[model samples]
Target: MSCCGPTRRTLLGAMAVATLSSALGAGASRAQRNSLIATDLELVTVTDRSVIMTWTTVAPDASGQPVPVASSGAVRVAPVGSAPVTMYESAEPTPFHYAEITGLEPGRRYIFEAESEGVRAVSALNPVTLAPDAPEVCGEFTTLVPPPGRLLRTFALGNDVHYGETVSGLIVGDFPPGFRSLPDLPPYPEVMLAALLDDLRAPDRGAQRLILAGDLTAEATPSQSRSVRAQLDSWGALGRDYLVARGNHDRPHTGADYASCAPATADHRDCFTEFFVPREELVQHEIGGLRLLGLDTSELDGTGGRIDRPQFDHLTGILTADPDRPTLIFGHHPVTRTSGATALAGPGFILNASDSTELQTLYTRAPGVFLHHAGHTHRNLRTRPDTPCDVEFLEVASVKEYPGGYTLLRIHEGGYMVSFYKTRTPAARQWSALTRNEYFGLIPAYTLGHLTDRNHVVHRDFSGLT
Candidate 1:
């Protein structure tokens, strides 16, 4: 009675064939009738102009592979209205399939579906729109481009999304002796990145760029690297481009293990660079009229962080070359304070002050250097020039830790608005409460009364620089 069922004559023929095969005790014909199973369906947006669709398959027999016999499976993309849909045939072997669909319009919604082997399977049919002209909302911030004679929008930034490690141990390697706490964070980088993309796509304000600042993975392990790459691909699918900087965690550290795992430097870095970095030397974009420069501060050394001579010179040259444009420099580590050292504790965890000063000197020389965006200290803190300028040193909070959040900046004709948003996860909130308790419990009696004062005094304002 089913639509795909055999007709009377076809049924009779099948019965005769089955009877003959059974009489002969053949097993091959019976095995051929089994159904196929599909698993691990992934849909990715490769760029504003394209979407990459992929999935995995588990075949009945391992000897052969899944192949498209004809133009059977079709993926359709349509607009919000009753517009005519665009359809494309899927190419195989789709066991682990990847497809790049192009010619999409920016800021438009679309839908897709797939079918196979007389069985139909449909996805959520979720509405996915093309990325907007500005940085779409992600976390607490909307992106803003500074216009001529306007107030500059400042960003709280950080990168190196090496999640999945716990306080007790790393899921992939040995934990550093000094590592304090690591609780289970949500979505890891993939889910978090998706949420960020969704936020950017929201009808609200968008960021000029997330200024990834760098090292989205713990190391360039095949799995870890792939996970990070997938997140970037997803960002692109959402029609956003990340200003990816280089970080120590992204490249292999110098050690026997690193050498053994990564046979070639180019290959190792290529795994990440190919997907994240827009260019080899510099990645630049315009927000309003301001120029945002993402610099690669990652050095080959396995130590803390540094900018090699070439990169330093390159930064200097870029700034010198474009004297007229207001510049915002983004990197993974703060140039001024490598680690906080000289507060009551005497030395906090942040960029070393000497290096910080050195970098500050370079920035100060250029009147156009409006802000320095960094993340290494997982705390939300801001600093400005002791001497005075339109420049500010803004450190963003980590997506994985206590404050577990991001900063949003709004640039307008007069000045910019800055606000921080904590990660709105149930688990993160619980950990935040625990962190506060631990902070109070560990401090000395004298320090206890001053804790609130010290915390409140850390933020800075840079409207004068603009």
Candidate 2:
């Protein structure tokens, strides 16, 4: 239970659809052609006075097949009893659109209609409503109340960069086809990462620091690790401005391409460790009096994660020494199962059950550890463990594929807010839209979590953090 205000999960879960899966599979098809249709429209980010909406435009192709097509985008927003306002007139046509509606009054409800090439977008009838039901209105959402107290810090959290991979959505065993970038275009990973950096540079999204939770590379090859490192260095001074955690794909590999590197656990070569964690130890850093703990949860040979004895002991000592210090933990694998992850891959997709249980027990002793950020499973989910502690386990979506983006953590004196942002660069948006069909079109249902999961406010007293 939350020690602050009302339980956020309970309140939000009450408005959730009974079964999102059934709605996605059984809902009536509202297909159309001969005109532009905006699909997958979502309120990606909702702040106190603004919301970022994203969608893909569909139009008839050369073969008369309805497909994602480039088109100008705009939105009509109007508060009740007020005239509609048009915003976000794109100068260039793009198949993928990100529309930011700003200048909204806090706590005011507004009706919105997203349009492209004169065709208005309609929300898919789903069991769960992203906002309060406005039956006759096209779409409606209430802006949030700003967190109380002075704003102190902002950080960008992203992961699953997957630097060297040419293909995405490839799983072992017989699965649906994977996707690759257009032959003449740059790799999808590079396109998305560049766009992420560009977006982070915006004044409104000014991120003082960055934390890439895991999966820094497609494979832990020396070349791949070096290339990824160079790219990150282009953004900021590595150890001071950004930190990285290891994911399953970053674990040492035994492939012949890495035969020259030093051996790691078992027969694999340790290129990722050599480049990222030269000291081969867990890292802890302090910024503005806030402690950041980076954990390497990758195992030697499997997708499941486990902390080494030494690293676990070090974490225990650190937490025991400063039980009340404001802290945020970042790692590759989630410590608990998220609904989206379970619906997609089952228990193996997260940290091993035993390790997760032990960590939860540890969290019980640390009152100031409020959030644990993780990647892997390529989804957006926020879950609270059944343990007595009040910490939240947040899983961010991938930066290298569909729904490509990161989450912004805004720390205020009295509380904090988290909002997920999809990469907005034109190329990045295109790649994201193309990969939405991953896993046989089941990705959206399992990866694009409920609105509450992606954007929400958590009240906590952190005035002492500096």
Candidate 3:
């Protein structure tokens, strides 16, 4: 359990549809009556204007025999004392039921009901909670309102989940002796991830959307990418509530010297793209009159980071279009060299100087580009350009290792503040404490934010955004 609020994981397990007490229909055959149990029921892809609910119903006879039965599923939405809207209905036997409802009005309250196997069930929890019901589900939910007061918007940033390696975390210089070779107890990435999500979902957290900076998988292999995406789908819908960027650890190549490999292309690859987000890897979106830009810095070699020309040009277009527009640019690698890495060569800490210089010039011109959030360094970093950078560069620690949490961005009309919150679930706190054993306990001193890294407030005259 989390100290912050009741977690989604608690609700997910609590609401399994098969075990709920509900009325049994009398019109069915004996086997039909015996086998109408629905399990693994939940909702995902829940946006302000839409939601997708999914579940699996196993119609097993009392004798534990698999019986073929025709099934249909649909979602209903309505206000009090009104005829409910049938948002979606389908008979596709994709081994489960997935129904979606769209075209909803934000900030309004509505009730949702899921019907499976011709039986309807309703849940007391809100649809945002996505709690299941007996052979179905119903809940009330209020769509998220636009960010309040001077705050134009809010987003949660997390990275370095490294979902599939199940082994050593990101210690990527000379391979440490007996590190990857040593056996891991088990994959604890999920525990850390669950904690992070719970913290993000907490009512006091106040993020309207989530953006993972990068390093989403461990090995950058196909299986790692697929596993990460699958887990994310269960956590919530990717495109609807959250988005991800690519990292060196998430590139399409591998080495099993720890046994690994990933087939690649000229400057781009499809492994991360095919599964994570179907849209272009480098893209920008405008929200609350501010632009949010995510960059893919995963290089061909997979160790260092670099931005290709195509993405740079695309970014140049955005920055030049209106250098005055308040924008947030995020990527996996830091352009400025990282502190606390005294043992490593200077080159290892950041992208090459030429790449850094090009961006520095752009940032100097784009006065409204106030912040840059990055990952992959797996350490908390706050850096500013030497040329009187108005832009505050913020780099967050990894999600799967060390301090193990994420940063929250609160953008207001006057200015913005960036705060780091450690994922505070019992499971996360336990794993975070245990995982400090990583890198010979040196990980905590640096990866956990020190002073300026965790909480930094910047004041600017951005009242013009209104």
Candidate 4:
């Protein structure tokens, strides 16, 4: 699971996941039964002193009856050898709980177990640094380690989580038999993402921030959008440790036909922005000395994308604020050449020609901008703008389907390195392979690329950035 794997697009084919998480009162029979099936367990947020987790409680038998809560519910955590476990219980009886723990020691590891009434389950966040002799049944996670030196911070980048998009074909909005929906697969986003969270919780990958470049959901419906946003929260809250950019699919789509049905947006606007990038159409922030600029370069009801004048200007101001600060700007549309199914790419797969040229020019002028990452092509490709600048335009593969994984960006004092790490959990790997042939079997050729796409080196003179 640690090794990099070939790329491919996963068509959910067919999977049925309950659309709702929390239900109302429980049936009398369920009152005493521990029918709470907790899945999608995740550490939603973790800081030097606190951590938050969220998960779903599969509802009771579908007899149109309400599900009962456990007689008692609490998250139990303890050090490996510690006998007494610390339990944090929620007063609410909902299936969805954001279990929170605070005042934890940074870099300390703990074994966590969650239980409510009749069910007790262990955490899946196994530690990456446990001793071989350590017990294997317990769920373990360590608080994030603080960056040591001139290293301003570390962040993780992932994209294309099409929640509710069981059939990969619908995501591309197609009707070919190959793009037809299959009803025999497991939940696409849930299983793959569960495995991803499992991997992120490990000791070595405690990224301080997470940015989803775009395509946050299959269709922007309320439930799907809500669920996708919640899934992202399984890592951290929006505006804090996690943020999102809009994708062409994330625009305010509306149609009568299911295939054409687009996920609903906020104020009839784009929910992708509402849920994650609520503060601004484009986001700009600084971590230590490292700057991150997130832009929404997508269009409504369109398969392609664009960097609107407003967003372009917003980014311009951000880049101008600290031209010398090491910065990484990202969005949904690619800005360079792509491979595979080239005929199907159309204009939107990459930025429009005019904008592309202008962006390269802007990047060249801002030498501090070392990386401009994107998604949407669902393939991994790295381009060095071909201008008088070092800005590398990289397009990351989709995270929801085959080759399910993400890029880890480690920012050091002088420069930074990006390495693609595939999700290691059995479920993630299984599902990724299961959906590998999406888009008429051309996804593999387009989404996965040469080994160079998975690893990159950026040597910049950062002697001044301590």
Best by TM-score: 2
Instruction: Select the stronger candidate by TM-score from 1 and 2.
Output: 2
Question: Which ranking of candidates, highest TM-score first?
Answer: 2, 4, 3, 1
- Write out the backbone clash pairs for model 3: 123-138, 255-260, 256-259, 256-260
Query: Mind giving the per-residue lDDT tens digits that candidate 3 earns over 165-278?
Result: 555543555443112211233466777787777777777676877888887877656677777787777767775578777777666543443233323554344466667642
Per-residue lDDT tens digits for candidate 4, residues 438-458, read 554344455555444655445
Error of 2 at 411 (Å): 0.4
Higher-lDDT candidate among 1 and 4?
4
**Candidate closer to the true structure by TM-score (higher is better), 2 or 3:** 2
lDDT pick, better of 2 and 3 = 2
TM-score for all models, in order of appearance: 0.52, 0.88, 0.62, 0.62
Candidate 2 lDDT by residue in tens digits, 127-167: 23323342212376777777899989998999999999988
Clashes of each: 29, 0, 4, 13
lDDT at 162 for candidate 4? 77
TM-score of 1: 0.52
Count of backbone collisions in candidate 4:
13
lDDT (0-100) at residue 39 of candidate 3? 37
